[model samples]
Target: MTDFTLLTVVVLTAIALVTAALLIARLAAPRTFNPQKGEPYECGVPTRGEAWFQFHAGYYLYAILFLIFDIETVFLFPWAAVVGRIGMQGLLSIVFFIVVLILGLAYAWRKGALEWK
Candidate 1:
């Protein structure tokens, strides 16, 4: 009914759900014993070479592109759906939004964030 009551209910529900899930997992899990399980491995085989390796910048490029275009598409769809009613002001706003996004891409390019390797 009230904000505090709603918050309390949400928190309690989350706690109960998490507790239930953990309890179920603990009860249902296999108890097999293996000395090899204690050792660190890649696909159950011991790791070779360095334990850590540097990730490629391509991951960041993909993520940034996905974020930018994904958001652009999301915003553009709704605007397109109502294009006739919003007039020139809406058009200008979207143009401004696009310009800002281009600026972000330009900044990323200048910083060499798009480079692969």
Candidate 2:
């Protein structure tokens, strides 16, 4: 076989072996199931009420807004790091990106997504 084919076979074999080992370990582990064990346990206290609960729409809206700004910050850090190497074109591109980002935030705000009450 060619070198590439040989390397591929070796990698695949390693992956298969690791998977089999993990499966064997899992199967060999002890298994225990009881009525209380299946139930949710919180801070040594028995869980009360329904496990699935609906969250307020406002909470979700705030979370989405937080995520959007958080992601913008994340992207900004890397771009800042490479700004010198990228020059004016990169700066303009980032400006455009930020403008688009601001527009999205504006749209969300206009739709009342930013309101707490």
Candidate 3:
């Protein structure tokens, strides 16, 4: 076989071996199930009812806003790191990015997405 084919076979074999070993370990492990174990354990507090429940839409809206601002913060770090090397062009680009981000925040504010109630 060609070198590439041989390398591919070796990699596939390694993966298959690992998978078989994991399956064997799982099968050999003990199986124990009890009423307490199946029930939802909430920090030692007994569950009252079904775990599934409807949450407020406001919570989701706030989460989305938080995510947007969080992503903006993430972008800022990388831009700050390369600002000196990129010089004027990078500075201008970052300014534009900040402006756009601010505009989005303004829009959200105007739409009352920032309001708690």
TM-score of each: 0.49, 0.51, 0.54
lDDT for each residue of candidate 1 in 83-102, tens digit (9 for 90 to 100) = 88999999999999999989
What is the lDDT, from 0 to 100, of the residue 70 in candidate 3?
89
Scanning candidate 1 in windows of ten residues, the lowest lDDT window is: 44-53
Q: List pairs with backbone clashes in candidate 1.
A: none
**Residue lDDT tens for model 2, 1-117:** 999999999999999999999999899988788878887778768888996889778998878888888899888999999999999988999999999999999999898878777
Candidate lDDT (C-alpha), each: 0.87, 0.90, 0.91
Residue 18 alpha-carbon offset, candidate 3, angstroms: 27
Residue 91 in candidate 2, Cα distance off native in Å? 0.8
lDDT of 3 by residue, 65-111 (tens): 88988898898998899899999999998899999999999999999
What does the lDDT come to for candidate 2?
0.90
Tell me, what's the RMSD of every candidate?
A: 5.3, 6.6, 6.9
Model 3, position 8: C-alpha lDDT score: 100
Q: Where in model 3 is the C-alpha error above 4 Å? A: 1-51
